[model samples]
Structures are given as C-alpha cells and as structure tokens.
Target: MSDVHGRSSGTGRLVTVLAWALLLIGLWLWGRGVTGVPENPARPGTGDVAGLGTATVPLPPAAEPLGAAPPQRIDIPELGVQAPVMARGLDSRGAVDPPPFNRPDVVGWYGYGTAPGAAGAALMVGHVDTESRPAVFYKLSTLKPGETVRVVRADGRVAHFTIDDIRVLARDDFDAQQAYGPREPGRAELRLITCGGSFDRASRSYTANVVVSAYLTGTGP
Candidate 1:
C-alpha cells in the first residue's frame, strides 16, 4: 500500500500489518470458540468495560436480516464519512488486509465474513491515519450510541445500523469475541474497527483498537 503522498513507505507497511495482526489473533480465537475447540482463558481485563452497556439513549429494535449482498459504500453521518467499500482478503501473514494507504478515505470489509445485513456480525476495518494524515476512521472513537451508520448494498438496499456500544480495547487484553461476535442471536450486527489509543512510535502501531458495535434497525431503498 502507498503512503499519504502516494509513495510506498516502510513505516506505512509496518503499521498496517501490525494493526491488522491484532485482530487476526482475536478472530482466530473467536473462530476456535465457535467450533468447539478448546480456548485459552481470557485475560482479566479483556471485557469491553470502557463503554459497556451504557447506552442510556433508547435504540430501536433490530430489523430482520436481509439476504446476502456485497456492500458498496458506508456512511457515518455523525463522523461526516461517506466512503466506498471494497472487499478485502487476508494478507500473507493471515491478517485482514486494509485499504491501500493512498486511498485513506476508503473502508475495507472482511469479504469472507457475514455480509452487512446478514444474520451475523459483519466485520469492517479502516485506517485511523496514514502516517501523516487522518484516515477514514480517524473519528471512530468519538461516536456515541444512537448514532447512525448506513451501508449501501449491491442489491440496492441501504442497511441502517444503530450504534449501541463503543470500546477502546487495549491490545494487551483484546477479546475477539466481544469485539466481533454477535451481540444478540439472530440479529444483523456490524463491527467497525480502527486503531485507537496512543500511538507507539517505537512500535509504529497504536496501543489499542476502537471497535464500534451496531445493529440493523431499519432499511431504505
């Protein structure tokens, strides 16, 4: 991936790989738990305590899941983001590949996972910064519950999700299930992820991850 100036940089590549590696480990653990594989005990602080179940604002009930369709774009009105969505596969290291660094305004969806409005959690990842400038999800941590996220699908339907939980999960104690797992059985869920917390210049990566959880509350043509 290219850097902010459209030139490939070693730092940019390192940051991208390290950031996605955090989720790769967590997602692997989550898959293990689902398949009846014995799992490692979670660390004491792995829970989403930063902003757990604190949505005092009432949210609408979840809508029924729609048929699978690829997402074409994503809109976060609260953050002033209207970015194209592209399917991303895992990198050689097994981490979910992110959007190219030059395209800082785009969002990457985990193409192998659940579709946005499907009956499971759809995973999306974006860059918080591109070494020099803020990226598509730079303001993701500031989002509050009850805000709206709209995903335009290829089937010509807009899946509107309502934000209900946000967390800054420390990398040392990250929990994949809590960050990416379904909040409620049979509800269409979405997870927007980006690097968060203070950047570690030494490691060229952030210390934590911002995960915004939402559920499908309505739809539009």
Candidate 2:
C-alpha cells in the first residue's frame, strides 16, 4: 500500500508539471499569434503619449546599470506608494503570479527575470484592485514622466529610477516583448504593470494593461 501511495503521488506531480508546460506553450502561441509574429505594432493605440517620442518634461540621464541584487522594497513618492517587494514566479496560468488579494499592498517582482538594478528590464506586477477595494498599483497609471521610483535592494543600496513612459496597452493585441523590453540597450530599466482600461464583467478582466517604464537614474545608500 505504501508503494502504491508513493506511485500515485509521483504520478500526480508529473501530471501537474505536464499541465504547466502545456499552459505555457499555449500562452506563448497566443501572444506570438499564428504566424509567429506580433499582431500589432510595438506601441499601438492612443493610450497616453503613444505618439510622443519622449516624456513631456526634461528627465535625468540614465545611470550605469548596477550588479545583480534582489529587491526588498519599492517606493513611488508621487503616488505615496511604499510597499514591500516579494519575488514571484509564474502561476498555473503561465503568467506572473501577483500578490494575493489578501496582500493587496504588496508588489511582486518576476523572480525568474532580470534583477531590479541589473542591465535589463525588470518586471514588477501588482493588483490594481481586489474585489472590495483598490490595491497597491491602483494609482500606477496616474504616474507621469520624471517622477521618481526607488527600489531598495538587498545589497544595501537603493536604485533610483525616473519614469519615462506610460502606456495602456490593450489586452487583445498585447505584446509582451514590447511592453517589457528594455527601451535602450545596456540600461537598467524597470516596468511596473497593472490592469487598466475598464473592467469588463463578461470577461471578468480589465480591457487593457497599464505599463509604466522607467530607467535607473541614480543610486542611494
């Protein structure tokens, strides 16, 4: 009986792994479209400064990328956001698993991707709202360029970023690479993502995603 139980448990784990693999493949296909090319341009629609090549205000120059270090906390002074950061992996649905509804004040960093201060676009996601009220990123879309976003790192240094772009990308033609990709090569960039547009009752999801792009401008102790 013990052997049989062990075999059953092993089979269950295997099935779970297979299911995740299938779901990831499906998500990749859906995002890449049938022809393996993105269905829309890198920036589509008029979601707030889509046609504008740069921020409306003058911004500081990009700082050199820092070495890899896990992030501990994030602060957006303009939005009055000072939240703890937790590393998160992909969920069963093959997407970044955001903080649980109960912990709506937390931010989830993509653990499998670039570190917050590394030379790549680090991805951070949070819930815009729970069933009852607003979440951590509820005011994310309201952030304008030139605002400051500071990330406290585990290495005892704070990475300061300057907001450069904001886009409300439609869900129908969402391009992961474009939304999360580094705007400039060798710069340590960050993308803060949350749900935007209007919530749809039929689909039970937001019609678009709010993507706020920023790059490292300086560091602090």
Candidate 3:
C-alpha cells in the first residue's frame, strides 16, 4: 500500500504537518533560532544548497528482500562508522526524537515506522554535532553515490543498501513526503538524515539538512 503521504487522506496531511513542525522543533532544540532564514548550508559550487541531485541506481538483481526485523547495528565501511541502533519514537510534538546529546555515538531509528529492510522507506537520524564536538553523523554529507550502508538486524540478517543520492535541503524546502516517505514502491529504502549546511551563528542552528538516500541492493548473514 502507498504510504499516507502518497494518498489524499487527512492522516497524510496531519503527518506532513507534524513532520514540518518537527523540523522546526528539532532546529530549536539543537540551538537554531526560529527567526530569519540563513544562507544555504553547503559550500557554493560543490553541491547546491537547496537540494542534492538524485541518481537512479538499481539494486543488485540477485539480492533477496528480508522480512521486517528491528535493526541492531549499522556499519558504513567507507566512512569507518560502526554504531549501535536505538529505537526512538516521536516526541510529544510528533517529531522523530533524536538520541540524547550525551550518547552521541548512538543512532536513532524511527521505530514507529517501517523497519530497515522492510518493503518501505526506513528512516534513521543522527546528530551532526553535539554542543561541544562532532557527533555520529558529522560526516553524513561526505557519503557519495554508489557507497553502501549495512544495517544488521536483530534476526541476524544484514540489509545492505546502495547510496543513490545525497541532498542538503534548506529548512524552508524540507518536504515530508520526500524526506520521510517512500522513494519507490515495493522497494526497501533507507534514509540517513542529519543537520547540515553552514552553521548559522545568529540562529544557532544549521540552515539545512543532509539527507542520504539509499535502496536495498543486497543482503548478508
């Protein structure tokens, strides 16, 4: 079934509204001011600050899809990142809750939504940086097309996804359907999200969000 965002339902509208509200709340909690739009977060002439370009890379034809299982760990070999996965729910404000600042090493999976490797989009979010130092997803913007992200499941299966695109969308352009909804129907997808772009000293928040889009390409034991 298509997700609520794809349909013309009241719930879908609510989700979209809540999603956008959460974006603002997240920025606020992370130290960004609600007033005044800042410049694009990414450096000029590299990737545009508004959006990241997308590429259609097919998953490995031989790979089999896995059943729904909670993710236990995540490994990005190219980035040398290996961290435990923690299930996180939305806050009272209906935003995807982030891991505590004290545990910068942990990544939060949107537990209320589709699990990783399931036949839908799975979301995982991390901090770009803590108040004092870099966080688990500080290098999220560095991920390139064709890289792989492996999510080990509680059932002992690993769902491997291929990076298809990376985008840094300004807060004003943040789209719930694009950021949190499914990319392709019947395909298992993954989104690694974190704050990005230039840090706005005046606002005390990052001006944009770095979103890495990937699709299930293969699986492992």
Model 2 residue 33 lDDT score? 25
lDDT of 3 by residue, 1-221 (tens): 22322446898767755655565455344322232222334422123333356655543542455677899999998778999999987666556677887888899998756688877778898876655566788777877777889999988889989888888767756665666567777888898977776766666566677779888888887
What are the TM-scores, per candidate, against the unseen true structure?
A: 0.77, 0.77, 0.76
Q: What is the C-alpha lDDT of each candidate?
A: 0.73, 0.72, 0.71
Tell me the number of clashing residue pairs for each predicted model. 0, 0, 2
lDDT of candidate 1 vs native?
A: 0.73
**Candidate 2, poorest ten consecutive residues by summed lDDT:** 33-42
Measured on C-alpha atoms, candidate 3 has an lDDT of 0.71
Q: What is the C-alpha RMSD of each candidate to the true structure, in Å?
A: 12.3, 10.4, 6.2
Model 1 TM-score, all chains together: 0.77
Q: Give the Å error, residue 175, model 3.
A: 1.2
Worst 10 residues of 1 by lDDT: 34-43
For model 1, residues 1-221, the per-residue Cα lDDT tens digits are 11112225787667645645565574543233211111122212122234444488888998998878899999999778999999987765455677887888999998866789888788998877664556788778878899999999999999999999988777767677667777788899999987766654455455677788999999996
User: Which residue pairs show collisions in model 1?
Assistant: none
Global Cα lDDT for candidate 2? 0.72
**In model 2, where do residues sit more than 4 Å from their true spots?**
1-54
